[model samples]
Target: MRGWGPRAAGRRRRLRFDGWIAGLGTASGTRLVVGHWPRSPFGPFSDVMAEHPDGQRVLLAPTRETADFIRRTYSFDAVRVVPVAVRHAGRTWTVTAGPLDLRFTTGRRGPLGLLLRAVPGPLASRPLWSALTDRPARLLMPGVRTRGTAGRGRREWYGARDLHPVVGVTATWQGADLGGLAPVSPPVRFGFGSAPRAPSLTRITTTVEVGAGEEDRAG
Candidate 1:
């Protein structure tokens, strides 16, 4: 594989997405994580990843472009392009994607959130910073990672700015109530990392860097 160097770096392009990621489990034995991005190279869009009790993984994206990008970066048993809408009022979030309807509320930031907030945005979002913090993040929050390979010769970095406990959630899939909120057990298996075990909403900036000569086709 080609390694990062001045020549390779010059051929790569970076795409950043400013968004909120919410991960939670329902009493019905389904774990769902939602990414609502209001700023991105492709404009605002939302995506949903749901894991059924049977361990089936599905990705619900708002468009083919978004679906292709997400599928390239993560693993999923199935991928679907559907209408995805995400709205929020205060600390509460509402989402509608395919057969899913989710509503959740977040509480005030906690200690970790405060600590993350202290880091300057420019420094925190740097890929180098994310790589340096990956191991520590895994130790501090099991299954969470700040940096990782994203397949297709792309590397990804997650810069978390803030986090808030998900206080409550009411969700339904295919018109079947998913019951109340619970811990995100078993950890989601979408990518190289999972969200914090404790259900929460996190404000983050995700950066994806495409390999040399691949910029034109990357999202």
Candidate 2:
């Protein structure tokens, strides 16, 4: 497929996930992990077996909630999937539900021309103006990186795996503060494809608020 369709298609299906173990690995001497499955070229990882340096097959939690403390403690986000019930006509019902009420860890906004801010006066703004005036100028800005496709890019940290049925997903990209660096966060984005991880039922409960007293349209 060519044109903008493919990119838009992938963007919409970005939340499909295979399992919680999809996000397993050690980084920065820390095992900061989450269970959310990003778009393909990223994951939908198989939780079947993990290999040790000695080539030993180890067991891992098949689901998020039942995962041991190690997975939970190091995770940046907690997610869960279970049953949800709603009451309206004196009747209650339940259905499998996975809810992601997520809030990204955010940084404060820095100067607009952060790169120029260090250029010893507004002369630094020259680059900013050039980059803005030319479509390709944005590429010249330091720290600007692009995500790759088809098992490439930063998302390809792990090799690859097959795709899975994704019920839904949401991604939220709030702006980031760079000080004298390039912008990291865009305006906004989010994902709801599947819960990033499953923990206690309490962490994923949906809250419903009811408002009292409605006015008549004729009034």
Candidate 3:
């Protein structure tokens, strides 16, 4: 979701967040929705009503600036933002924007950098970096633009559905299966494409990591 506050006198920063909603309709199965939330707080409502070719509706929560933009641009009855139902790990693992379950380290050079430096030669990690950074090459996005954001973390999961055809499968854990895991976020940044240009504050994400012994206890 985008921040709702006084807009910048000049050009305001552009932030895009992506998330999956409960199946928009039975026919469509699941609807993929994106919001110009940073651009409009009222944007979510517009998306919810907007029809997809596949017969799906989008839900969005536009920032305050977005509300004004809608009035200025479309001239419609903008409604208050509706919080979408976020399904994290179901009852086992709750999903929402708060903190991530994993640890993170940031610097001008982070894991990407360390991996690069550890490798030998001038173009040592370039290929690896490109592979990991560019989603399309890895089949996530088309380009690479590495800027600094406030906080960045990734939730590593093993054995999940195959979402993209090009990449085959998102990076996964070795020798682990029979479970589902998702990266938790406070202000979850949808992976792929580019990182946020704005700086974010650090936060702790609390999660329930089920133990092997505990799994035997029936709910």
RMSD of each: 4.2, 20.3, 18.1
Name the top TM-score candidate.
Answer: 1
Is candidate 1 or 3 superior in lDDT?
1
Task: Please list the C-alpha lDDT of all candidates, in the order they appear.
Answer: 0.86, 0.21, 0.23
Tens-place lDDT digits, model 3, residues 74-159:
21232334432232232121212111111112224334334434544323212233334334323422222222122122211111
For model 2, the stretches where C-alpha displacement exceeds 4 angstroms are 1-28, 31-105, 112-144, 152-219
Q: Model 1, which residues run further than 4 Å from truth?
A: 1-8, 215-219
Cα-based RMSD of candidate 2: 20.3
State model 1's lDDT.
0.86
| Decreasing TM-score order of the candidates | 1, 3, 2
- Residues forming the 10-long window of minimal summed lDDT in candidate 3: 159-168
Error of 3 at 59 (Å): 5.1
Return the TM-score for each candidate structure. Answer: 0.92, 0.18, 0.23
What ranking emerges by lDDT with the best candidate at the front? 1, 3, 2
Candidate 2 per-residue C-alpha lDDT over 74-190 given as tens digits, one digit per residue, 9 for 90 to 100: 221333333322111211111112331112222222333243234332232122332343333224433221121211111201111211211221221123211221121221011
